[model samples]
Target: MATADTMLQTALREPARRLTLDLRAVTFFDSAAIHAVVRVAERFPGTLAVLPSRQVRRVLEISGLASQDWFDPS
Candidate 1:
């Protein structure tokens, strides 16, 4: 999970005013990814959004990270 951790670290350090995760082409959304999204939201607060792919939507939804409470899809 080194790659996942690195990706998460990179995202956490982003200086954007808003953070949008476009997972529309992602085939795999694991716990690490889920944690990353949560971390981003915690860091950016209302500036977090997500566009998850159909392939990984179920995983994200089931994980309780694909919701307006977690992020707004924009």
Candidate 2:
């Protein structure tokens, strides 16, 4: 499970844009992780493409962060 701190740290260095996450590598994501993603979206410019697992999507949905465009095929 990658910690939010670690994830945020990586995001900081990477150019802001679309972020495709392979949730299979992420075994856990607590509120802190969710908060970090929100923060990144707010601070960065452009969409954060989250390729989360079904479990991760569940978490995002329950957290009110999931939207129709989140996984849109288009």
Candidate 3:
């Protein structure tokens, strides 16, 4: 997940408007991963779209980061 985070950090440098999280390949994710994503979102004024599978979505929903606030509609 840290590797994904690093790539995300770098991706944020571009002119993209949203961050799509493909959590299909992710076998597991911890609080640290959630925190890292939140921190990264804070770095940007826009939003972050966490496009996790049903399984991963459950984790994010339980972790309290499962709102549109994290998803960029713009």
Top model number, lDDT:
1
Clashes counted in candidate 2 amount to 0
Task: Give per-model TM-scores.
Answer: 0.78, 0.72, 0.62
lDDT of 2 at 66: 78
After superposition on all C-alphas, the RMSD of every candidate to the true structure, in Å, is 2.1, 2.9, 3.6
What 10-residue stretch in candidate 2 is worst by lDDT?
Answer: 65-74
lDDT of 3 by residue, 2-54 (tens): 57567556756767666665666667777766766677677655656665666
Question: Would you list the rank order by TM-score, best first?
Answer: 1, 2, 3
Candidate 3 residues lying further than 4 Å off, grouped into runs, are 1-15, 71-74
- lDDT by residue for model 1 (1-74), tens: 34567767887887888777776787777787777767777887887667778756788768666665644443
Q: Looking at candidate 3, what is the lDDT of residue 45?
A: 53
Off by over 4 Å in 1: 70-74
Decide which is better by lDDT, 1 or 3.
1
